[model samples]
Target: MSELTVRSMTEIEFGQWYSSLVRAYADEQVAAGNWSAENALQMARQSNETLLPDGFATAGMLFLKGELHDGTAIGVLWIGLTHPRGIADCAFLYDIEVESAHRGAGYGRKLLAAGEDVVRRHGVSALELNVFGDNDRARRLYQSSGYRVITQQMRKTLTDER
Candidate 1:
């Protein structure tokens, strides 16, 4: 497998990348029963905008693209420099996605390693991320990458009959 290279996402790549991210995130939310189809897209956009007010130049936010040495785009990773719990020098991974065509290959793991290296180079001591309960694949990848679950949120549907 070719080593993955990580680089800052160019402004030219942000538009299409963000669009796909928003749509996919919305779909994931809908699938997880957190949002209805009608409002998922809007909510995704709002959440992303709130997190990335300055777009690619947003302070403390890193938008990165992963590729092979040959320049084949393998995936993208979005990480935050500030840790959620106020831990200094820690980073949060907002998202990491391997292109659909590259799915099931080792690229996801490579992309994640690349992201970690980038954060480490920035002086970050640790990295964290959230994976939906239903995304078994992602959870497995993360676990195998040495990330342990520090917290979890569970929910149960309650119907009028129940």
Candidate 2:
């Protein structure tokens, strides 16, 4: 019931956060039907390594932790300052999450606002993120937060039909 604050993650925190992020990302991939459970962990690790080649010191990446004034961790926000498509000053939101235990407390929006403030301080003009189609809750949150869809993808599973 206090103000949420975002700050740079420490090395020790990064170690634990990275481990949990890898597992959670793998699980999310499997749940979204994007990767087989058997290979999801490996793939997730590879993907993360590719994006964060220097680990916590990656030059253009920012790994932030969100917590309340009382120091209860709400979640994390990971962002990339330099986008690949040659978009100047456009930041990419790699990940953001509100811990399950704190989900309905409006911490998500607070965390997002905090993250945006960080990006704004960096003089970044735009921020973008991708959400899995099946994550209706996340989609709704993003939409309600004034984030409009820039692109969309759709698929039809044929395994059941054939």
Candidate 3:
């Protein structure tokens, strides 16, 4: 496990991070069968239209980059302040990604732990995140990190010929 550092994203870093986020979102959407590849790309572009340039500056949102001990960028984490179930204030992890090449090196786990420390400094006691059903790796990571399933959402595809 390398020493992890989480820092506020600079403007120059935002462009690369945003691109990765959009790509991830589209891929997840496609995996979930919510949209075709083409449609997912279009929808992802549209969905992020307002989020760039300055959206993360909104009330209680944070965009951070994770770096290794040598200052190599390893990942990004986006968190938003939210109150779930009237719990007052909690941190919601909107997105987290470890660069493809850095996967399986324990970077993701370190990045998440660093993220929790960042959120905790903001006085948030709880952290919540949503992971797609098909994302087994992420599910396992979150579970190992002490996150529990508070709810489960299931979907069914009905056939017209039936």
lDDT by residue for model 2 over 1-162, one digit each (tens)?
689999999999999999999999999989888999999999999999999899999898899999988889999999998775667888999899888999988889899989999999999988889899988888988899989999899887887665
Task: Give the range where candidate 1 is weakest over 10 consecutive residues by summed lDDT.
Answer: 81-90
Task: Judging by TM-score against the true structure, name the best candidate.
Answer: 1
Q: Give each model's whole-structure lDDT.
A: 0.92, 0.91, 0.85
Q: Positional deviation of 80 in candidate 2, in angstroms? A: 0.6
lDDT per residue for candidate 3 within 1-162, as digits (tens), equals 778899999877877777878888998889899889878987998877654435555667788999987998899998876653445767788889998989999999999999999999999899998899988999999999999998899999899986
Candidate of highest lDDT: 1
Off by over 4 Å in 2: 159-162
Residues 1-162 of candidate 1 have per-residue lDDT tens digits of 888899999998987899999999999999999999999999999999988989888899888999989999999999998986787778999989899999998999999998899889889989999999988999999999999999899999998994
In order of appearance, the predictions have TM-scores of: 0.95, 0.94, 0.88
* Model 1 bad stretches (over 4 Å): none
Winner of 2 and 3 under lDDT: 2
Q: For residue 73, give model 3's deviation from the true position in Å.
A: 1.2
lDDT of 1: 0.92
